[model samples]
Target: MMRASLPLRRGMPTSVLGSVSANLARPSSVLAAPSASKFTSLQSNKAPSNLSKRFYSSKTPNEIASEAQADFDPHAITAMDKQSPPEPGADFNVVIVGAGNINFGSDEGPWNHSFRLEHKLGPRLKVVGLIDPSADRAEKVLDVKRKSFVLSAYKDTIVYPTFADYVRNRDPAKPPHAFWVGSPPAFRGREESGRDLEKALVEAFPNAGIFIEKPVSTGPVDEAFAIAERLKSAGNIVSVGYMLRYLKVVQKMKQILEENNLKVMATNARYIMAYEHTAKLDWWDKSQTCGPIVEQATHFCDLSRYFGGEVDLDSVLAHSLEHFEPAGHLRRVPVPEETIAPEQRIPRITCATWKYTSGAVGSLTHAVALHGYNYSTELDIIADGHSLRLVDPYNAPVLYFRRPGDDHEEVVRYQSDDPFFSEVSNLIDNIELGPGSAPILSSYEDAVKTYALTWQIRNRSEEQVRKLGKGPANF
Candidate 1:
């Protein structure tokens, strides 16, 4: 078994970061600026107070790639780029709309690294502004030489409160090039900044591209569809936060499925994290975060769909365990104060079986009360009189087999320099080259499917409990 460990540390090697900075410092020479670009020249206006020459000029390509590969076994970069070399100095300006942990900084923050990688990749990309409600959090982006402003308490900063506040306030000839929405998922009886961000993007910069975080919402499916329709009508290119879709390992798995001509029989996925990591927040409760199925397990569900093909649930069954006393000394409460009985908390364990329209059967299981923030994601596929298993996400290799007579395991490792960097680089290339140039791995359609699957599991579980006349119901 591959030893699982967190990828981030305070004093871990800064070589990659330093290399990225060096690349940014090098002048842009790769791609020519778009003649019809919407973004105004920063030189024309007094650059945002936070903007600095250092931020723009960071690292060199060789240095960035070298640092990215230092952590892993040495592999030739050419092995992964046989098709096409990455486009350099592509001009793509971005306006990030949320300052969440995933996008800005976190223990294993892909977004944080992605931003730096974008700088190294070329001048085609720039983060111009950050729009978030919390002033403190917004200040983080402002410190990076990007404009930061508190968004109004309205859905879609562009339409509800009027786009003139932010857009018209600026030069109309040059609008934001793109909007990146990294807000948390909207919960039941709670605030939803994503909807607001989407509205703003559609109204203020209908022609700009957009990137929204996952688990789009906790509400009905129709709402998400409506938002998608609006984006489509506005001629915007919207990408969802299904980052795994761009991972090299995931791509290999897809290739394996196609090469084998296999049919999926059953799939099992589990994600376990430390209770201390999740239990402290109000949104940790299943109802608030749209249940474990939607909030946490949706990624695995999306993976299952990717491997197993189109998933249409025939039925779903679920159960929950609440906090209770062993000797009747303490009565379990639905919502605890200060501390919660282990049992009374949200269901630590969840299991569900989904029957796809293609006649494939699949299962999903997950838990969040492990010893530490240790995450294990696996997919077991039984088909063609054989079995294929993918255990542990970060390091586990794919295991495959042929039949009762032929049994073997072959490791499937990323043959690339850095999968995460490759993901961001591809995103930039797609935007620069336009449609058909690069693959669009993650789409709003896939996100919708994942969201609906999660909703089905959560809603079905609550309905089953209601039918059984059980207490401690979920909202």
Candidate 2:
């Protein structure tokens, strides 16, 4: 829960302003030769030798920069549409709202945002502000990521204890070009938590791009839509982080469907998380995390909607394997004593089916049953005589498909694809290059539907439990 923010006022207390360190007036040097043979002031203590350890990176940022490009005309279409370029040294500036796994990648984190930005953009990405209510927690996460990432970009970054603090004391001259919101779903839609900050960001930095991670909100559909309306009015460039939508393999899937003029008939999605890891965490508590479907499986749910189009909310139906379900080959996940009994916990697995407004149908199966630090996520689309399957989207995503009258399944592999980078890059490009860049696929308004679907799946699944008179003990 968020504490009440200080009302907007004139005089700034030195304590709230202590976090601002970057001298916006004194622009740094292209983040000082970010990924070169020579070291820069912003370079990390590490010498950049552990490339093998990273699971998704195919090449170091320097190797990809390819400094050998020929000079282009300033009159080119890309340069023409580009927004007023930043100062000589600053390429992009953003304020990140959270300091959790998404901001700092874990071995088992859903995605990498800050770590990748520092690694790829180096000193060129100026993080002007870092906000979290728990300043100590935010500092800890920053410390860990700083040690691991290639650049120490946030060494002098501003730290705000709350959104209100950032609002009150932020330098009016150096307003960020974009806002990177990685806060939890619970803080996303509620006015006191999400919308208030969102509205403030809009008023404070009109037309600034916002990159929001999913599920965009944990509230009802109407609540999210209300926030979306405000954003639309401000003309803020909004991109919700459904990163899978940017995958080259997913793009190929879309390309083939368009090439063959195919309409999806049915879709299948499965997201089975490694149970040994997640069960011991707060995720096992249904009330806190809003169940696994909304918190975790929502990626697949959004993907299902991506290909299947608008969902018929009335047609959503779901079932689940209860925590108290009988055990045989499957051992029940141990329940935390604090949560009190297995019956009150979220289900071990959930299966749901729903229809698209386009008449196509979709199904999803999510289980918290795999072992160790492993997870399984895959989605398949079936059109008339064509089939499209995407596997292991997080790393080395592969697409397998068969068009009309094909013998065996053909494959398109994008082992080096970084949808995480693509998603964030697109947000920056959309702001800079406008229509010259590919537009964001998942806008704030569109993401509200995905949030609503996850809630619908969770609600209907729990309703099934209630029908059997197997309600939680608290009831």
Candidate 3:
């Protein structure tokens, strides 16, 4: 059965590399901007600001993707690209949950959600509040966003200790329009999942849309399913953070499949990331990040599903390069020997394969043994007479393909297509203009399927981890 998105609104911006970079050493204690003093949330009795004056003409996934691809250019840097982004004249207000690297960005590049929103919607977006465990970090993230995008002036954004706190103190008259949940995996659908948080948000903000990050859960698909059901009934606009689905390269690939009316033969994806000290320590803990497949490489896994359709979860089989295997080869995280038990460490490499419901097969290979802050990633979609490849989506994204009757391969390189900005922008557009006006590429439930598949991959690969008769001499 074909699954049509639940009238969730979505759209994206195109072209130009971003100069912003998030290098927060300790977000909880992120230093105040050089010219600024300490920051504080303002107490406001005023009602939510008026929605920005903006309208959009977008509908259906394929249609939106086609339009974005048509307007996108690999090398056109406009004057707007060089100047500081204009204020977010948002048509709606949203509360951001979690203020981690994914939200604030890190040394690698700008995954900053706030920056993306303002850059795209100009004076149309306004962050009314932030929800995180650390009030300090949440406030700082808002401060940083305020300084960088909204004229270096503090707005009336509030910081709550948790989502529940925000709910308790929310002014019924000044309700937000949406929420962006960017918390880590452990807090998702696992140890202490956001099951309750999701429920609360839906009930409290029935009219607001929701944008959740990937790997909707660390383990177990049930929690995500339940959240999906709640969101469905509430009729809240929903989007998952599988931004890669919005890439022009990916859009072009889908176009090929449709134009030729071809079925996917097989899809193969890989994400080998550098696991230096640059990453948070939680990333190395499988219990926290749920291994590389669940936490990071999920992008490729989701893409695999996007092109190949539903999966045969029972068909999964996997293998991995354990930490004990070449002791010298796998550069270990700097920590005391006793701090990281064997079970806690992530795999050096993981390779898994499974079948799709459509009779097509797919495979994935993930690694976390790089020395620096870079990732080597790629995805290959094979059809009867066509082959599509997307390379290095993290930085400069490019597409390479060979179509029927073509003797040579053609390449499409995007100078800079920030999928992060596109993701947030589309959700806002959907929220402003109402559902069906745009397409939310990754629905919460749809992202759950991707989450479940990654867990299957991680579990299958770990079956052999305990069969070690003798291990490497010790790191």
Candidate 4:
């Protein structure tokens, strides 16, 4: 089994503020002064009372709004207009940014997992450039032919050896047509690195379609909105890496919901990976990498909303725990003796509840305390007359329909192929098709929604911890 640990690499200073570091000074006036009247009713009625008892017993509405505006601007929305659909088979050059494990050949990485998909895409979609802070790593992963363009170091593209100059000097006729950002979450005490890479991409390649990894924002929500806004203003295609959206099982689940004319009542998702699989990296700690909510549960939140078919998030309550006493004969991994102080450690367990605008409810539970390589995601959708269930990350998702007269279950399987290809292909098509067409499977807007929900859960959970005068284990 692959262990999840932060690798210690000696090179860049940890504190260097990259181009995309959180810049809280430039506030969005719109988010700062949202229409309070429009949200008064919802705020008063749906706000979690437990949160008030624990964290905000004496806070005023204005104070809460101010704090929220600092993290996220409810009013910010992408302004990119959908363009006219392109002819089928139109070719485009793509520049892949961030040679992290997800995008490139890391030890047992997903990038290599998607190789068959890349082969399927063929010559039309060429990998024009590869970007990563580590030149050697990038070179090893992106070993292009002699005639192919392979820029090793990130700074090499400009005057300081940056991507800017490379793009400028490249044939304007073939400027990178698209951009794929497969970097990890800006956790691992490398928040600035993630931000810098994003800023560089935005400034250097404004015209390319941009795809970012999941949990789009690792720190302040406002920073994420700002980045999204910049991309929107630049007329860039920003698609987040919520791979489940493209999964055959999930697609079939969507079809099931539409076919039954059902409305979601409640949803639940659980993710369990071995602690060893996660604790390998330094950034795996909660304060840096984000709790399971932002790091992993974000996927569940997004998929729930996707299946629920709603946009407005009403409220959230969350709790977490970092240590567990082994029970029975269960063995426990010994905590590292050289581990950082307790506060910086990631939680082993997390639970959160979401009340959506559509009157449906959602809950998520995830833990790294499990003993084996186990990953299970189940969504329970309850409607007026029946309930539907979806299970598994891959195809052959089992579906159970419970109706008044009869109870039956059916398994829907997708043809044997790479789910990533399906999603990437759809993204390319969406980029070419422009906006207003059958909306892209997942959009930047969806990314923002998932990110916001994850942020609220983590923030709210932290508030609970602070109010209780205890650490993460209390939850």
In model 4, the runs with Cα more than 4 Å from the true position are: 1-91, 106-117, 144-162, 165-173, 187-206, 309-314, 324-331, 334-338, 394-396, 433-439, 472-475
lDDT of model 4 at residue 421? 49
Query: lDDT of all the models against the reference?
Result: 0.46, 0.61, 0.60, 0.49
List, residue by residue over 236-306, the lDDT tens digit for candidate 1. 66666565555555555545554566666777666554344332233333323334566567777877766
What would the TM-scores of all predictions be?
A: 0.70, 0.77, 0.78, 0.71
lDDT per residue as tens, model 2, 1-475: 0010000001111111112111011010010111222111111121112321121133322112112111111122221123233334565677887665556554433355775565445557877788866566678766765675434467657778767788788877667878887665544553443335567778778868898777665445555666776777788888887777777777777767766778889999987766543333345554444566766777788788778877777798998887665631245454453454454366778899998867999999988676655467789999999989998776557888887777699988754456666667667767877832654667776676677778778778777877887656532
Measured on C-alpha atoms, candidate 4 has an lDDT of 0.49
Using lDDT as the measure, name the better of candidate 2 and candidate 4. 2
Give the candidate number with the greatest TM-score: 3
Candidate 1, residue 210: the lDDT equals: 70
Please state the error at residue 93 of candidate 3 in Å: 1.5
lDDT of 2: 0.61
TM-score of 2: 0.77
Best-to-worst order by TM-score is 3, 2, 4, 1
Which of 1 and 2 is the better model by lDDT? 2
Residue 206 shift from truth in candidate 1, angstroms: 2.8
Which regions in candidate 1 have their CA more than 4 angstroms from the true location? 1-90, 113-117, 144-164, 187-196, 324-345, 394-405, 415-419, 473-475
lDDT of 3 by residue, 163-196 (tens): 6678788767667887877654334433222335
Q: How much RMSD separates candidate 4 from the native structure? A: 11.2
